[model samples]
Target: MQKIKLFTDSTSDLSKQLLNEHRIDVVPLSVVFADKAFKDGQEINTEKMYNIIDENGKLPKTSAPSPQDFIDAFKPYIDDGYEIIYIGLSSDLSVTCQNASLASQSLDGKVHVVDSKNLSTGIGLLVLKAADFINEGFSSEEVAQKVRNLVEKVETEFVINTLEYLHKGGRCSGVQNFVGNMLKIRPVVKVVDGGMILAQKTRGKRKKALKTLLKNALKNKKEITEDRIFVTHSMDSEGAEYLKAELEKEVKGQVIITDAGCVISSHCGPKTVGILYIKK
Candidate 1:
């Protein structure tokens, strides 16, 4: 079997250490703030981006990687005589997947691209699974199929403290005014059918929302196990830690907490709490 290369974009939200350990290559997207652009996860980090947002009163806009960026990332593996698989964020969220496909078209069939149909640690989890398969000496095609299967099995749940951020980001236009008016409403969001969709609305209290997340997650405890539960937060370590403790009490397994990076933190804003569960 030929050597295989694993590729993913910065939106996967895998930390630098994880990426390095897995030997996964990342193509970075751009974050533009007030006419200045910084490479996501490269020149800009989560803390820096949030500080800028705090001062500016608005989050910066994010841009997908250009086709050339993809080409530059993939050319090395192709030249090294290895088959390449580029896993990326959802097409519904961004065009990074399409751009990777386009760039691979010029690589003469040496590269394959997959849209994870999810974002952040959702994509990160898939990439990590793929890396394990690669370490097990799986072929590129086999790893791609495995990633596709896993994508269909993963679920993400999030609770936003306010609708103001979603409204500003144009994600909650229809119900923005109504949801915003009700100070008691805390939006519970989930990734359904490959897109971020509202799952439930509860009172806007942090403790109550955390309990709700744990309650919902326990409903499918059979699917969750020691290695598959992930909790992510945006500038709210305290909230995340609280959720982590609560989740441990509800589920009989260990949980990993990931900080929402620049790409995801830009949209979710600060104090966002979420979990990603994959059924074994």
Candidate 2:
């Protein structure tokens, strides 16, 4: 059997330890400011990006990796006689998946690109699954197909603290942003069918909104798989840990906490918390 290599982009929001342990490679997207551009999680990180946003009062523009970037990332492994499976961010959200597909075309069928149809640890969950299948001696084609099949089963939702960032990023209308902030309305943003939607809204403090999100997640605990769950946040350690603690009390699966990457943070803003998992 041929060797299989795993690849993912920075939006996966996976920890460095997990990436190194699984031997997975990453191609990063870029966050562009007025005068400079920083590779997500590479040249810049969440905290620094937030600091810049605070100073400038504007969100930086985010860009997907080019086809050449994916090609460069895949060439080394292909030459080493390994078949690669690259799981990237949702195509509905960005063009990263398309660029990866283009790179695969030039690589002579050695590279397989799987659009995760999700973001953050939602993508990481699939990458980890692919790694497991590869370690269990699954063929590259099998791993790719299995991951693609599991895409729709992933559940991604976040309780955003404010709509200012979303408005600044051009994701929400100006009037909605103003009214939401005025009324202290926190939104539960869920990733559905490869795009973000307002799943629920809570009119109160941020903590109350988080609790509502937790309640909704736990209400369907029976359907949640016992593999793993991710509590991803943007500079919100308290909220992430709160979710982790609550989940550990009832969940059979391991609950892991992670910081959302710069690209995700740019859109969601600080104090954003999400619980990501796969459904059985």
Overall lDDT per candidate, in order of appearance:
0.83, 0.93
On a 0 to 1 TM-score scale, where does candidate 2 land against the true structure?
0.98
Residue 230 in candidate 2, Cα distance off native in Å: 0.5
Q: lDDT tens string, model 1, 112-159?
A: 788899988888888888998888888888888988888888878888
Pull out the clashing pairs in model 2: none
Off-target runs (Cα >4 Å) in candidate 2 are: none
TM-score of each: 0.93, 0.98
Best by lDDT: 2
Q: By TM-score, how accurate is candidate 1? A: 0.93
lDDT of 1 at 161: 73
